[model samples]
Target chain A: MSEVIIPNVTRDDRIGSVFNHLFRIIAESEKLEGKVLWNFQDVHFFHPFFVFPFSLYRYELSNKKNVECKGMNDVVQSYFSTIKFFDFMDLREIGDFNNVLKCYKEKSYTPICRFSLSDKNIERMQSIIKDVILQQIKLPINIESHLSYMLGEFVCNMEEHSQGKYGYIFSQYLKKEKSLYLCLADDGISIYSSYIFKEKHLDKIDEYESSALRLAKAGYSSKDRPEAENRGYGISTNSNLLVKGFGGAFFILSGGAFHREEAENNIFIELPKSIRWNGTIILMKIPLSEAKNVNLYKYMER
Target chain B: MKRNTIKLSTLLGENITSRSSLQILCNILKSNDVIDMSDIVFISRSVADELCYFEESYNIMFVGMSDFTRKMLSLVRKNRNKPRKRQEQDSKFVVCDDIETLLSVVSSI
Candidate 1:
């Protein structure tokens, strides 16, 4: 049994480095039949996107090695608590943090949810989101419809494309900023590999940048088979709606690539040298004031 | 030919997240001649994208779609027409038997 210290943890999405470290631990503990202490005493910035890869490796590592996470700051603790990330980590200290946003309660404006591939659950999730939108944001029926559709499309992307057992969604309404953050993540195939099987010339797509760009482009999909209609519009359309249509922010992080959209501009962020994400994460931020009554058609044309 | 009109919201029980509902709609479209997308107050782009598959076989018309849905449908249609480079013969990444295998390999990495 050996304890390892993880220091200088920040909101970095370089998941490869973290995984490499954990894999080293697994390799070290291959013969040991004792719990491995994973000390996080110096963890400062824990990004939400880290949750997906962390959840995946945590389960895998727990099979042979008893991995424990220790010493997290209050902010990191609160963020993890809000999304119940600690539950997946097997950290019993989760009760210490108070989550202000609870899902589905009438008084709560935000939802932190984990759902399965059941239709009833999907309906219930959408209803809760719609309720919050109606109460919190002042937008036309059409704009509301667009947002709802975007939510549905992303969730279905999880159901259809993500080969994972479950999906997670967490949203929060920031009072001071008047922005709503919606994050949906799944432990499934990376976007680059999703298209690799179905399309040709994917080799031209550099894993770090072009993978995210290809997903943001309209009519680019890995679901080009005869059984199901191509699902190119799920990410591409939502990207347009969130950024160009509503003046919000949109991001898709998968594997080592990160794509972000702000207003009319879309940027492909290069992944940090030693980072990789095992699944896909979609994060959207909507400023309710700017999203209302905007002409979505103009953006759709783009 | 009898006109078969299906309201997407009503057919989907106002829940757009369910792909089963899309399958139901696609199944119905196979037997009908016309589909009125007019009553659909809202439609997700993925659903709209699926509707384009029937464009060649069915006489699809939008009777009362709101501006947002109309634009979304047009976007799907327009995007469907764009061209792309064919898949390259030589590959660098490991090609898997299915998406499942590919995902498992990624997680193992």
Candidate 2:
């Protein structure tokens, strides 16, 4: 078995380099002359930025003959399924980030699995997280349900509204650290467009920071079809779950605006300068101890 | 009294009427006394499908129909005519061109 290791790479633009390294691993592994051929167990110290390339590689490998990958966590499985869905819809060749953005702008519904878990995937993840919480964290049933629901709802919005390209599903179950990290990201339209595009009178309103804050309060949607049954509860529910339930932090960066909802009630503080990205990324960290009693259904109900 | 006006557009010169437009004519049948449906320009397959669904969902009577709309409805009826299981009953369809004629039919019923 052949192996390639990328050493001490600390640049975000080194995505191509990591891909090259993985490609070499795949090529060598295929031609190895041993029964117990090339294995990826020796892979060490993958940069967080390597997630996208790794996901793409896994997807390609899954389609190849005589190649099978297993033991992936729920997050990785969802990512794999999303890529497969996009490839099935012939969207894998959408080439370039700009083209992805353009397709979203056109609302083409081309079945591109933009970088986030869909609602279906989120619900599935919630069930898995809830079971882990119940068994490991030993939390009350209600608490377990609450946390799971909130997490699912929060992550689902990344797919429902982003209209951008690519989504990320990152999960780590660290035995030593006794913690779990789950993050979902998408490069799509932002909360600013959620308000600005539908409201013609808000054209002069340039204060995106304030706008994002107001939207987070409750009962807000920028969709033109206001008569539709959109209760605008996602942001508010996320706030309650993160702050009141878990005493956690909820951060949102969209449309050149940033807001952090810390472990407090109804107190949202704004940060200076937006992250200036075309999408949203949510990173959630929960101690395995605290997550034990997280009931997603109860959280969603509340 | 009945009055009808038809507007022609595009080279095909075929009249086009949407399901919503047909609903408007249905409303006219319900309200007005005179029947005139000569103004209908065209009816596409989509409109016919919607009308079939609408007939199933609502209790509506055909007032008046142009020869074109009538023929289209007949074609759909003939195509869908089949003996199926009891659970697979087909939806009803009605075709009418003039609101006044439809109203007269409904009033007579």
Candidate 3:
């Protein structure tokens, strides 16, 4: 039996450290065999950006290998429970997820949720999420509508491209900073894998995840369909809106590559050594107050 | 020519992203057909570009657009109508099946 230690991580000023720790886990995760023990004793704080991907990972690992998670302090346990992180690991507790996120114990969050392919019911979740954001946080109508646009475009693109059965998501609104943090992780056809099927992309992107990430940033769609079908503008325009327009941070992690972008700052990309992310994970932090900084028409591709 | 009315909110919702939905509508529409875009707060750039694509085909008219929707629609239209970039036709790079093939090509260089 092998053991993996869950670290205490948060999305703070030291975000580079958070990602480095995440990469270390991915490098280690690929090696585990037989029964595995996951120790959460040191995880005093687990931000969704740091923990939601693992929630999906733990769910996937359960199907193939024996995995057990134990030892969490009250703070870690409450954060996990509030986000419904523990529910993902326990199928019996899931109960089809019909009753999840019913009570908004915390006004600022929506629990970790799985948007399954069979149901195709992201609308209900979107409604609840939008309501939570609007009611609790007083955002300008334009910001509210644009945030809705970002969610619709991002998730619709996910549904169209991923081809994976299930994707996990969670969100939170910070009152003081007036920022909204949203994340979605899917063990699906990653950008690297998606390009393999699209012969049109064969020349544009290398098979390497880094190459795929570059094309993705450059407005290349991974759809195998003809260019006339108009399949790939979602990520490009939305990233511009979030990172460039709102002065927010956008992060995408898949395969061995990771990218982070923000306005008036240098773009960050990491080709982590020996790391293999079986799927894709994205996190966006949008400053609601800065929606005025962006001229919507200016960001759209002409 | 007989004009038809197409309500965007009814076609999708207040916030629209799916462009194919409108593509389907355009097939039944004709030149001068009116698309009612009232009550629509947000439409993605892709969807706006699709509207631009439809303009070349059907030449339909979009009416009842709020200031926001109209601005986005006009921007995409103006941008698409700009002078075109000459097509390179894949002369810039080599096409391969996967990453392994790409690696082989790079190693040879």
Candidate 4:
């Protein structure tokens, strides 16, 4: 039996660091036979930041080999289980699993689960956003509208580009930090592949570096017919709202690339390369104060 | 012939998210001679772009939009045509502040 111990992956660490570590672990797991025991002995804290991307990894890995999680303390276990991370990966013997489920049922304001992106689901996500805004930051109803547009554009983009089965969205409000976190993950053709598949000019783009940054350009889209199509503005609009409008940070991980918006110039910084995110992870953090003063109408173009 | 009037916010509800809904509204704008945007509060960029496309087949005039909404529409039109701003300074999209101005503009058209 082969065993792999996962290091502590927490929000305090750079997201790239954790992803690179996971990439190495996944690469190593290929050598092991039978089920790989993924131990979390040193993992004292499991940050919500990694929840969506980790969930995607777990799903993709399950198809390749059996990976069992072990040695999780109550706090780490509860956080993972509460987000239904364990259940989605089909892991067994989750301690206090019922309690974690109870947390979601009780905290209807925050929904952490795997669901397809549809209009009904969009409303559910909007309600979660609305609740987070009201509780953490008092924002106008227009905030709900803005979040809805962003989420809708993201899901619609998934439907158009991701040739995968389902999309995942989860949101949580950090009470202490006075910030709201929203994450959307999908396991499908990533931004790089989508562009390469559709665009003619950049058929030979370096998957590791170029594809991720080009995704931020406003007019650029993966759709085949740009003149006849009103597509390709989803990611740009979301990025605009996050970095330029609300003055928050936007992070996108796709196709072996990590892109973060520079607060100074609003330009995307291509961080060090790691393992490719099979699909894509859109993680956003907006401060409470910014939410209250955000001008959705002013920020968004017609 | 009386120009057609459509309240975007009323037709699509206070917060519009569905792209198809905008398409349906665009259909109404096309079937009519002229469409007015009197009660629109906010429009997503995608939806705004779609409306811009509809302008090719329909005479679109925006009226009664708040400063925020008007600014968004103006920006969307400009951004949509950012590559051809110099050539197309006279964008087909017209925005009137009040119904009186909208009537006068519509009468001229």
TM-score of each: 0.67, 0.40, 0.79, 0.72
What digit string (tens of lDDT, one per residue) describes model 3 on residues A1-302? 66788788755552233555555565456578777788888877766566767777777777787877789788777877777886652112333443444465346777777766434235445555566566656665455657666776776666666767776767777878888788877767877787876555788765456677767766667652353434455666777777767888777877666666655443434353444667788888877776655676666551
lDDT (Cα, 0-100) at A13 in candidate 4: 32
DockQ for every model, please. Answer: 0.18, 0.01, 0.14, 0.07
Q: Name the runs in model 2 displaced over 4 angstroms.
A: A1-144, A174-178, A200-206, A217-219, A223-230, A264-275, A288-302, B1-109
What TM-scores result for chain A when each predicted structure is judged separately against the true chain A? 0.67, 0.49, 0.85, 0.78
lDDT of each: 0.57, 0.40, 0.64, 0.58
Question: What CAPRI class is candidate 4?
Answer: incorrect
Model 3, docking class? incorrect
Q: List the residue pairs that clash in candidate 4.
A: A256-A276, A302-B76
Model 2 chain A worst lDDT run, 10 consecutive residues: A103-112
Higher-TM-score candidate of 2 and 3: 3
The CAPRI classification for model 1 reads as incorrect
Q: What is the clash count of model 2?
A: 37
Q: Which has the higher lDDT value, candidate number 1 or candidate number 3?
A: 3
- What is the fnat of model 3 with respect to the true interface contacts? 0.12
Worst 10 residues of 1 chain A by lDDT: A89-98
Error of 1 at A254 (Å): 1.1
Candidate 1 residues B5-83, lDDT tens each? 6666665554455454477777776444555555455566666666776665565655666666677678778766555
Where's the lowest-lDDT run of ten residues in candidate 1 chain B? Answer: B86-95
Interface RMSD of each: 9.9, 29.9, 9.1, 20.0
Order by DockQ, highest first? 1, 3, 4, 2
